[model samples]
Target: MITGDNQHAAMRVANHLGIAPELVFFKASPSDKKTVIQKFEQEGEKVMFVGDGVNDSPAMAQASIGVAINAATDITVQAAGIVLMSNDLNDVLKALAVSRRTLRQ
Candidate 1:
């Protein structure tokens, strides 16, 4: 997770989600988040970014696939390829499942 939140707060949430410290980036500016996604793309990684804030727009536009929550800022939703109507992150999984099923046909 790349977030503008401070390290301490980010780490607390990360730990709860069982995310490794190495994979968590805290206090990242919008540009930093976009740079990280660019770096991953350069390394041949397919990145899927999920966010719901104005600051997340740049990175969201940079990702291979951007998922935005219903509560996201207008800019964020505009930047995303997929917009979830629900606030729950679990909606992302549901969207994925739907996509996979549609693609199989």
Candidate 2:
């Protein structure tokens, strides 16, 4: 997982998620997400982006799969292919776990 931040709160979120500071690319622009997505796409990786902010809309739309909370802004929800029913992070985690398990099967 990678993260970037223009604010301390953003950086703190990354840190809270246990993402290494080095792996977290902090920046003041949404272009950071675009750049990161481009790199992964260039590497032939299928990328999925999950976000609830307007700033994340562009990159999320660019990704192979975009997941957004139902409670997110209309722009974000519209850009995402998957609209999560729950606003809880734990619900997201559970969905991911289920997906992984199903894939393993």
For model 2, residues 6-93, the per-residue Cα lDDT tens digits are: 6576678877988777656666356778778878889999887778889888888888878898677899999998789887877777
lDDT of 1 by residue, 13-54 (tens): 999989999989999999999999999999999898999999
Worst 10 residues of 1 by lDDT: 91-100
Each candidate: what lDDT? 0.94, 0.78
- What is the RMSD of candidate 2? 2.5
Which of the numbered candidates is closest to the native, going by highest lDDT? 1
Estimate candidate 2's alpha-carbon lDDT, on a 0 to 1 scale.
0.78
Q: List the residue pairs that clash in candidate 2.
A: none
TM for every model, in the order presented, reads: 0.88, 0.74
Which 10-residue window of candidate 2 scores lowest in summed lDDT? 1-10
